[model samples]
Target chain A: MSPVLEVRGLTAGYGSLTVLRDVGLTVGEGEIVVVLGANGAGKTTTLRALSGLIPAQGSVVLSGTELLGRKADARARLGLGHAPEGRGTFTDLTVDENLRMGGLRLPRNELPAALDQAYGLFPQLTPLRDRAAGRLSGGEQQMLTVARALMARPRLLLLDEPSMGLAPQITANLFAELRRVNAESGTAMLLVEQNAAAALTIAHHGHVLESGHIVLSGTGSQLAGNPSVRRAYLGV
Target chain B: MALFLQRLIDGIGNGMLYGAVALALVLIYRATGMVNFAQGEMAMFCTFITWKLADHEFGLGLPIVAGIAGGVIFGFLFGAALERVVIRPFESADHLRQMIVTLGLFLAINALAAWIFTADTQRLASPFPSGALRLGGVSVSYHQLGVIAVLLVMALALRELFGRTRLGLAIRGASMNPESSRLLGVDVSRMLMIGWGLSAAIGALAGALVAPAVFVSPGMMQTLLLYGFAAAVLGGFDSAPGALVGGVMVGVVQAMVSGYVPAVGTQLQLATAFALILMVLLVRPQGLFGRVSVERV
Candidate 1:
């Protein structure tokens, strides 16, 4: 099957400082691709470039459409959703408003159903719907970012470090929810993560990003068992 | 007692107008993190447009309501156009430059209005029926009550816009976090432009409403702008409800100080508003209704 997202020779960075260099990857329909990297390994930059939050070079095509030259909002409308690094939740807004903004392009009639699905997956959000998102726990905020990205009902969702500052148990729970979302909705995901063990648990395929280059690629089970991955990331 | 009550009502009526302009200040600040120093001048220009529509110059001699409506529509377009032409160019520049640009706008608009309106103080007719309603001991002018009513409706409409509608959500979202709003398919630039347009329209309404009492002229808003700034700072820079409450308090304080304090009566009434602003800045920088943003690393 054709990949939902295809990137070739992707390079992006802040002005005068290149972070990603000639990186290439793909995620098939309903697949979860986890990118494992250490701090400053260009993981967040990759996601930012894909989301058009910053400038980038090379090719990023989503479901056969070239996304280069499109602005961030236009890319979002074209069905590419990114739950950015640091959660990026509208902290002052109520949980309900945050979720509504997530599916901003959805038809008015479809909003209720989309909201219901989000609330159902993260039942913890139901009670806090009226509360501001900033008041939520870190884990809940992570869930909110993920659920918000789902609001767009994108063909491919890009997540930057969903496990940042989250407890192990919470991280496990988040990955489980992500798996369920993929299974049910057939949505593809490109997950950027530092937590190797938890990320690989739900990922079907994995790539290791080392200094803006993809150093290794394999199935999730293979990478989880790899000696290099275990030494550098898994800490096994 | 009747005299005291009358002053109090008058203060509130004027306060609401100040609050209207202050609301525009707050909206622009929240959206762009920059204050439009030219806001008062923009309102002054729109008020002139309002006056022209009502005057026989155009020979239409439309009524006050239609004139105000024309002012509002013109204000909206003019505001949007200004953002695109003047502010959008320096969008990425430093905040100091942005302030300078607005200052330039202030002088240009003020001068333009003087040249066009010819420095004349025109009598802008009041849409409200003249006379007063006597209730028990206190009497209130219909014009004063009308100003209060208009401000109340504006506050409610603004509340509804921010709280209920999708467009409002987009604006609020853009103001709070432009980057996130963009990620969510909201055109942040477009939202900012709309914010300017809406704010200018509100300012026009305030100017038109107060013109009859103050007289419509190029420099009429100069003194009122100080009061409006004081009201905005007193209420907090980011809160709408705070703007209204702050405006009323500033108005009441001025009235009370001028009336009760012998020295401040007429000559130093403006001083009272200025003093209140200084005290608020020194003591509680966040203002009454503004949140003290705590950043968690």
Candidate 2:
């Protein structure tokens, strides 16, 4: 499969404190690639850097277009969608409004179809379309965030810790939906997660990040079976 | 009873003017999360522009409505340019720094207006027919009725803009959570600039509407600004509708107090308005219509 996203020598930090260093990864067409790490291990940092949320020194090429030094909104207009850590919901906006925001760059005629597609993926959101996103339950907000990100019909979706505060069953359900989305839409994803087992279940390939570096990378099953990844992330 | 009704009508007219300024303040507050101290001065400058355009002898000698339209357009450009050139650098700065910058603008713009306009109080022609409509025992001036009508229309148009448009959604989203908005493809900076532009344009209109009554001068908006702040605080700093309602309430209270209360009279009317605002705020800090914000840790 051709690569949808490619990164090389990615390094980023907040102020003087470096969080991600020399990190490199790629997501192939319709591929789900997971980066698993512990707390403060640069998992979120890597995604933030890629999404242009922070300044980074790297070559991040999305479909041959260099994304480095671009602002977050510009990258988004170029078909990069990010559901940032902590859900990144516009808490004051209604569910439908949030979805519309995701499709801001989409043609006006295409928005309704995109909205319907999102609602179909996360049917629970349909009934709560007028409800404020902040009032939704944790699981529902996560669903809305993911659904909102998908409204852009992005070529590459970057998800940071989608399972952070969700219940295990909800996490499982979300991962399943994510996997279904990948299979059906042919959209590529680069996911960062601490929920190793659930992430690996949907991810085609995985990388283990340790202290800002990609220490190990392999197929999903290989990373799932790796002793250190299982012991460090899966708590097994 | 007739006197009471008359005062009430007069109060509402003045209140609408205050509401217009308060609405401008609320727009900037919602967009930038800061009360623009320079709001009134910016409007004052725009009013001067309108005066220059509409004045028959000393200026452009355009029709009153045309001059106001020119002022509104100028206000939009001026406000957007101010955001891009003066405010953008401090986009990430704390509230204190931003406040200082606006306060600096307040002084600078005031001085600039005084220098350019020669600090003279100029007369702006009223677009309304100078007559009173007699209804029952009370009479309402056409100017007063005109001010109320104009402000209400402007307010409703703003409400429609914010509630129905795609640009409105982006502005609302950008203000509520800029970082998330950027990820969603919102040009947050552009939205903020538009916010400033909208506020200043509204302020220009407010200035023109009130100019006939108060006359155009460097310090004309100073008292109005105080009243506008009271209105905004009363309405809820974050709510657009609240500002209008708050302005009307403040205006009514001021009029009633000055009319009926022996001690308050005309001199203490401003003080009485604040006293009421203080009481309301003490009870509901979020103002009349604002929602209490709660953050999740």
Candidate 3:
């Protein structure tokens, strides 16, 4: 498949601190692309930059749509869903209301079907739908965060950290569902993760980052089996 | 016994008005995290507009009812303009600076009102019809009943607007998380402006309604705003329901204290709110309805 998104020489940071520089990548349509890095390595910045949270100098084109200068909401209106690092769930809002904010760009009539689909992916979210998102368990909140993003019916799903603090079993389940999301919806994803072994396990393409620039780029399995990666990152 | 009942009723009436203004303060805090010290003054400013519109000569000569309708629209527009022109630039300023800024805005508006309206304490006839309904032992005047009715209606409309409607939901969501809400297609700046505008309009209702009973003047709302601020804190800064309940309770307390406790005269009314603040802060800093939010690693 041709690339659904193309990023070249992406450079972003907050105020004065530069977190990402000279970073480049491409995401094929319906592909699961992962960015694996240690803490504070500009992984979250990449996602934020793409979704218009941080101003950046680079080309962030989703099917040729320029996303760099747009406001966060305007970018969202163009179908980019970002589940920020630590899930940023509205603490006071109910799970139902939290999800409602995701698809704020869609017509009102489409909300029910989108909600039903979201609830299907994470059945546990259904019972706590009425409860405030803040009261949810860590794992449950993570799921809610992801589900909330899906409400936008995004063409590109940018996940900051999907496996953070999740149980191994739940993490596995989440990865499986993510794969399914890409497969079923034809949605492209740029997932950032600190869990190198786990992220490389699911992504079709993988890029390893250290101090901002992409140091290694290859197929997921190739990166996973690399001896250098195993010795340094995979903790083999 | 009749005198006691009468004081109690009057206290409750005043409390609701205080609550109305307090609710405005709370609304501003929730959306922008700043208190509009001039909340009462803004109400006074808008009420003057109502007074002008009701004028027979240079004015539109509209009926009192028409004057009120005009006041509501003008209040909204003026509020939105103040927010956009004044409050918007101060968004990045620290809380203390913001507080001082709003205080300045309040003083400026008050000065303008005094200059235009001539600082005279103008008598404003009751917008609502004047009458009292007797139910067995107690009598309820239309003025008090009218205030209560208006407060209730305003509360319900606010609840529905913020909780259920799209515009309201967007505003609610936007304030709670500006970054995420913006990405979700909400214009955070515009949303904040709308909130200030709505809060201003609500304040106009209270000021205009009370103009007749209290008399309209630039400094008329100084004391009332304090009561409202105290009520908002007592209720929880972010909880609208708390502001309402706390307002009514505070009003009733003031009335009862004036009646039962001879020491708590007009001078001591302000003291009552300060006392409430001390007691509430000692007990529940989150106020009545606010929940403490815990952050996780």
Most accurate candidate by lDDT: 2
In order, the Cα lDDT scores of the candidates are 0.89, 0.90, 0.85
Q: Write the per-residue lDDT of candidate 1 for residues A1-236, one digit (tens) a residue.
A: 78899999999999999999999999999999999999999999999999899999999999999998999999998889889877599888888999999977899999999999999988989999988888888778888888998999988999999998888887888899899999999999999999999999999999999999999999999999999999999897
* Candidate 1 Cα errors over 4 Å, as ranges: B57-59, B93-96
Model 3 over residues B34-120: C-alpha lDDT tens digits?
Answer: 778878888889888888888675466679888877787788888899989987788767779878888899889999998887698
Give, for candidate 1 chain B, the lowest lDDT window spanning 10 residues: B288-297
Candidate 3's residue-wise lDDT over A134-177, tens digit each?
Answer: 88888888998898888888888899898987999999999889
State the lDDT at B51 in candidate 3.
80
Chain A alone, TM-score per model: 0.97, 0.96, 0.96
* Clash pairs (backbone) in predicted model 3: A73-B182
In DockQ terms, which candidate is top?
Answer: 2
lDDT of 1 by residue, B1-297 (tens): 887987798788878888888998987887677899999999999999998889776425999899999999999998889988999898778779999999999999999998987687888888899999999788888998898888888888887887788988888888778888888889988887988898899889989998998998889898888898999999998888889888998988888889889988799989998899999999999999987654334
Q: Per-residue CA lDDT of candidate 2, range B128-237, in tens?
A: 99999999999999999998888888888888887778898899899888999998888999999999999999999999999999999999898999899889989998
Q: Give the least accurate 10-residue stretch of model 1 chain A, judged by summed lDDT.
A: A84-93
In terms of TM-score, which candidate is strongest? Answer: 2
TM-score of each: 0.95, 0.97, 0.95
RMSD in order of candidates: 1.9, 1.4, 2.0
lDDT of 2: 0.90
